[model samples]
Target: TKMDKHNLTVLNEFILMGITDRPELQAPLFGLFLIVYMISVVGNMGIIILTKMDSKLQTPMYFFLRHLAITDLGYSTVVGPKMLVNFVVDENTISYYFCATQLAFFTVFITSELFILSAMSYDRSVAMCNPLLYTVIMSQRTCWMLVAIPYLYRTIVSLLITIKIFNLCFCGYSVIRHFYCDGLPLVSLLCSNTHEIELIILILAAFDFILSLLIVLVSYLLILAAILRMNSAEGRHKAFSTCGSHLTVVVVFYGTLSFMYLQPKSSHSFDTDKMASIFYTLVIPVLNPLIYSLRNKDVKYALHRTLGALCNIFSQSSVYHVFH
Candidate 1:
């Protein structure tokens, strides 16, 4: 909405009371977001480190799992640190160039993550549905390709879109409500016409969402049928259990995704909108490592061994020092 030839009128300034403006709120919010961000970093990075260190974890499945952890870290790095600093800083303003950079990274990593998750589901499906063929089909070469596809694809697409968005002239309404450079919301502020870009975005989002969803759906459907065919109830139960948590993660990812981008852009709600952002941006990355690691016995053993070894080393050093 243009207010004047020289100015772009903000219809809703969803004023995010930055730390400098609300001195009373700064301490509390800063402490809160900081803790959440740290937990996300630790949980995701723990998976990455554990997967790399444990020889038993060096399978195609864990290979993708490590990439998934990497993506979550990528996701958090884009949103978390910036918001944390903003909570305590005097001025919360990010420059146009920095904002654009943030926007590009956010899009690239998110698209990559979604693609990786979809590939993971397919991997699980193949393993469960056709155990004999899993190794032959999901070979090292194939697994590596699955990882590389998203990184390359999203890098190209996001770069193109970011260039399109930032090239448009701004009409002076520069305050972004929620933290980060949300592509559509940020694009809405342009002085030039943005309908073309939005349609392109809609097409791009639809491509990412539907393609990933289709792969996931197909994978699960096959897995479910295979699980049902298992002769013993216990066998079936174990098979389904392996994928259940991953399925949960996928549902949450797509559900929040549909709310954020699937809905007509015309119907914008600030509070609900922010909530949807939380789904992919903050919550998904944090939940993924926990979900994959929690019930799986192997992951637990690996983590336990890693911690136990560290403790034993400390105890041995103490004994050596006492003798000395």
Candidate 2:
């Protein structure tokens, strides 16, 4: 154990070869991602603020949505700034402990998000299938539990995996091919046999993926059945509208993730993986708030109400200052 611990410190740091290696492309790419990161931060933050401020949004759907926005903001914050810095700098180095920390937090947020989406799906199913008992079934206490369990579960899982990955002996070469310190990329750098670590990553990823996806699939199926049985065209249309934004989000998030992680190892390319990672890490966060705000009339109304209230407050303050 002592020797293994000693060996772990052999590689003091890792150099992150970012999204692109082309000399000319770095600055333009940097500018592009800067805009993306800004949009993501603003969009997710707006969702969070709107959900908190609007009485109309004080429902289970918005409750789940608020957490989803938090996670989108969390993981993006973890990866975006550092990657942006790397884009402009000469040496894209991350220290041993810092890399481990990045991996851990990234894992927690990403995994928690996966389960949260599933929870949202289940919430939708209840709303559609058992409208009478929806409130009773998804009470404030229940919503808190649904959100809490995922964060706790993912924290423990991230801790164990981070410890396991860092415990392995890395060869002299400490260059990671991806933008962020991802598990598989780190595992690939090990001088020791990587079979066990690789297996652990694969098993955990597969399990999380399948389990959460099953929840979503089953939930949507129930919603579909409920929708089909509706006697009125208006009711059916309303049901579809209620589920549309969430369904779109689920499809985009899961589709990018599945393409990135579910493929055979033989087909794995770091470049291709980087593209998929960008879609989720940067693109999805921007897309989510836009998707929800644009699709849901409730959110749009909340935004207008919130802006009106702010404007009134500003005008009143200006008038007071002018008189003083």
Q: Could you say which candidate leads in TM-score?
A: 2
Task: Write one digit per residue (lDDT tens) for candidate 1, span 203-318.
Answer: 99889889988999899899988888889999988887888878888888888888877666578765577777866787788888889899677899999999999999999999
Model 2 bad stretches (over 4 Å): 1-9
User: Candidate 1, 263: how far from true, in Å?
Assistant: 2.5
TM-score of each: 0.92, 0.97
- Which residue pairs in model 2 clash with each other? none
Q: What is the C-alpha lDDT of each candidate?
A: 0.82, 0.94
| Backbone clash numbers for all candidates listed | 0, 0
What would the TM-score be for candidate 2 when compared with the true structure?
0.97
